[model samples]
Target: MIAPAPGISLGIDIGGTFTDLVLHDPALRRSGSLKILTTHADPVQGILEGTRRLLGEASVEPGEITRVVHATTLFTNALIERKGALTALITTAGFRDILKIGRERRYELFDLMLRPPAPLMPDALRLEVPERVKADGTVVTPLDLAALDAAADQAVAAGAEAIAILFLHSDLHPAHEEQAARRIAARHPGLSVTASHAIVREMREYERGCTASANAYVAPMAGRYLARLGAELAAMGIAGPLLLTLSNGGMTHVEEAIRAPVQLLESGPAAGALAAAYLAGAQEPRILAFDMGGTTAKLSVVEHGEPEVVFGFEAARQARFIEGSGLPIRISTVDLMEIGAGGGSIARRDAIGLLKVGPDSAGSEPGPACYGRGGLEATVTDANLLLGYLDPSRFAGGRLPLDRRAAQAAMARLAAALGITAEAAAWGIHDVVTEAMASAARTHLAERGRDASGFTLVCTGGGGPVHGYHLARKLGIRRVIVPPEAGVASALGLLTAPPRVDRVATLGRRLLAWRAAELEAAFAALEAEARGVLARGGWAEDAPAPERVVDARCVGQGAHMPVTLPPAPWPTDDAALHAMITEAFTAAYQERFRRPPPAVPIDLVHARIVLRGAARPLALPPARRGWEGPATAHQRQILSGGCSAMADIYSRPGLMPGFSARGPALVEESGSTLVIGGKGRFSVLENGNILVELDA
Candidate 1:
């Protein structure tokens, strides 16, 4: 092991199928990377393995890692699998029915079978305490200590390993909830407790309660896993700070992550989006970033050089598309839409005589049927293989030789079910799955008032390049860029992220005639809280300045839009601050609703502050001056333009930047393959990005 060194950053991203690690040494101008299969039973194994490989490749000691930035899907999986510790929710007496009441709207209008997601806490476990606070931060009912003690006793006896305290409107005043949590923790010495006010102080009782419950739900798991990981790294002589990525596109200390694991639920995907945003360079704004991993595909809309920011997202839902059908959580997150369309996405026909691709996947264990590792179901990989979109012998840089016969046999089942030839069925599955992804992208963009045609698609991840061109065709996107080492893009993306934290408070006050001094104090408090977290994450004293924003809206609006705020005194003049708030609302309103609402009293719903440390740029490998060689004539028949054509096959790595491959050619990469159709021309970018352009 080498000694601890400065200017070295380590990033680890644990996805459903793979755990990717990247080690970057800024001073040396070099980076090392590894992508290993995630051990579902124990994700740490994958991390350790990947870390060891990266360190070995870089010839550096574990101590050389000055920072370890981690992102994992463990919390999201725990919620989806119901594998977290037994948890109980403690809420204000009158708000006991908040979870049951929900927002009172069906996700589907016509389906009578719609079932809202079951609450995380059961009625028996949701012990209520006698306390209340008005929406305006005014105390309504004094907390009943005797009743609260009784509730705590009941929760402890119920075998709860953790407790969540969420008093009604606690965002305005956390005194009651904080006191309740302290009392409960004191009584139950070893039990983990989560207070809604501490985790996320915002409006909406259901979202607040749900977020706290989720934090408590994953606390035990995160704490134990992180502790073990830290020990493992220590054993290897790495003494640097371990930072975990957050859904807000920032990194937090491991201690904060252990306390609020829900914040890391969508962290992995957020990193990929950040990478796309960074790679888009000068065209950052109005770009669509597509990340297709082995288990899932995530889409994020980048507007004005920044990804859209979302305050709330759900997880562990039975149905993917149905809103209000999953565990709700309130956290600052990079706005993203996910679908189960990736390398291992299973493809088959449903009972209604219709073809279906997935929301279910084969994952990495058995992987695609073509991998020939005991998987029986046909998947996207099998479909691609059957259609000559993949080279069976050259798969994964020859590390994994795909069994074409296995892919064919699997597709044969689908062919029999659909009453079509195996070849035709395979092609249909490929086309339909591509259509499904394109449709999802279109719907996601449409809802946000975005047009897919105007944006350049940046594809990454293991399965991204395989489907990038087809997805582009379906979306009518003329240009697509597939960067070098596309499969490891997410891991590389992790290195470009900053160490930061987002803190918010629910004030719910009107600006007109409101006390500006009090508001300034509240903003200061939030900023202080954010800075504290940043400092704990080991942010350098001379790092870039922190950022602050507020979630505001007109009094009558149902939703709040984020508004940026200046640091410090926060505009001394009441009129000036009001004008700034109004300006922010008008700009955000036009972006979302396309029009600002008529004059109405403006309200400051939530004050948010973000602190971040400066991040170093990623190092790019210089491009090769020439191609691997000319493509050899291959007699494989492929369906294109409603006809069959013989295509030529070529190696991917052999192709150099500025190299152009015409349509009717098969370009094969290690983890994926690209099928260039007629009228399509593919060129490599300066940073070794593969650009595929199709003529209309």
Candidate 2:
């Protein structure tokens, strides 16, 4: 029985196929988790159903949930489906076509028929106002209030619910943009407005404008959803504050999130990365985090307990793997790579008579054929069910039963297309998806300069653990870790993430001549703004001092490298501090380029700060200890080496710590299981994690 405590922290993550919920009671050091099929039409409905069921099953009241953190792919889906509110873009006069006239370079170098992606807002809705600011924070043409009103009038008259304002050089001087914002707000009180400077304070005009418009495109939709969700949660008697996870894996109150929904993009994958880092611990300093959900699989690298962080990432790319083929979203984000390998991925024969797994998925509405939700397609899940990798009677803890006959029939239809037997088709689908994952992993890891053999694979999400063993084998990894409740690890990550805020400002000064006082003043101003953001999230008072970073580059270089400042309370002497900054930049430069410092002076393009609160203490113990139970095993027919083999299946929850078993074994749990190959040995570890050691 779960004993009542002061309060419970609830973590919820909504993915393409499943919605996972975890309730953690810090006082008792206990957690309860649940996975439910996602409601495609109304995602919140799934949350309501899952939450009520989990609370009741765990014997907890709604009021006991003191903290609520949520992460989802909702915003990403909204962008892809073009389901955002009608939006308009307003820019400085003569720059109405800025979004259309983006960079000259093509993402696909020699593709003859290639065309750049269309702007988020229509041309007719992109209005311009009379305003200008010089490159170095000087006002050239003052804001014309009359022109601004005319632009606002056009946007509102065009039935736009949200508007994005972008003034050239706003990053260096934001006065005109700020003034225009005040005027627009006063005139159009109901329209959601996003200022370019507020979203991205950088030198790139096109990128900054695109980021702002994207935020505005989703702002109204997110605001309505968050408001409605918050009210409903209050009505449900859960009075705690509702927080949303950001792309960088930090929690922020609902109000702050509503203002900038772009920051919440790809947050689900980031949470999964955090969970992997947490589970890896210090012992496994290097690991690959593979989170395979229903729609896609997310892969990330974690080193020394920290997942890699990148300054920005592309979203909803036209060419999925091409960098510049998508909208440039410049925000601090976890560096994660995604592949089209998931349980719901559809399998079909291409025009070339080659079998191909998906970049398209069968979402929960009509999931896999075995789900019995009216789906007719043979998906990965359907193949898994046919291979006996999944139990028909005990799927999702019996809440959702698998229809084995339906799965077999679907596989037969697919096999007919490829001139093969149904059983062969089933294994084909399984192997195809695993190979796709391995192929993508190799490319991503190679780009990051990492070798797969040196890293331990940490698997999460519903599908990761089941296919992880072979996936590891394909990558030449010898060890794999499947944490307790692997299916709900992403949600659990939300419970442990700290509240964090990131701030950035363009410096536009030569570091050699910049005085320490001048730099400190600028950074101080940014820190104050960041603190205000934290204050809005109710964390500023107790949050630690922010970390400092500088985007430094040579005088003739187009791009800058980020260098972090040593520590807080910088040196009082100007010469001493300048020396510290110079030394750090040279060291970072030498490390990346492997050359001596250039003769040219260095330019400081942008300065950044990250303020964060302490994370919740929810790390698992080294082992489940005295709670061990019997590791009784049973026999089951599992597909192996293109044939049926009887494998020893053990109950995961009943297995005690240190329980060891050979390969050709299945470890079953309430939500998911571990499918080990015949070439490895599997064991239950001290912290309730399952460790599989592959044969050399």
- For lDDT, the strongest prediction is 2
* lDDT value, residue 422 of candidate 1: 88
- Clash-forming residue pairs, model 2: 623-686, 623-687
Report the lDDT tens digits of candidate 2 across residue range 548-586.
999999998998989988866887677888889889999
lDDT digits (tens) for residues 432-512 of candidate 1: 777877888988898877789998888878777777888888898998877666777777777777777778887777877
lDDT of 2: 0.86
Give the count of colliding residue pairs in each prediction. Answer: 2, 2
Clashes of 1: 2
lDDT of 1 at 312: 84
Residue 317 local lDDT, model 2: 80
Stretches off by above 4 angstroms in model 2 are 1-6, 619-633, 641-643
Minimum summed lDDT over a 10-residue window in model 2 is located at 621-630
* Candidate 2 similarity to native, TM-score: 0.96
Model 1 root mean square deviation, Cα atoms: 2.6
- TM-score of each candidate structure, all chains considered together: 0.94, 0.96
Worst 10 residues of 1 by lDDT: 1-10
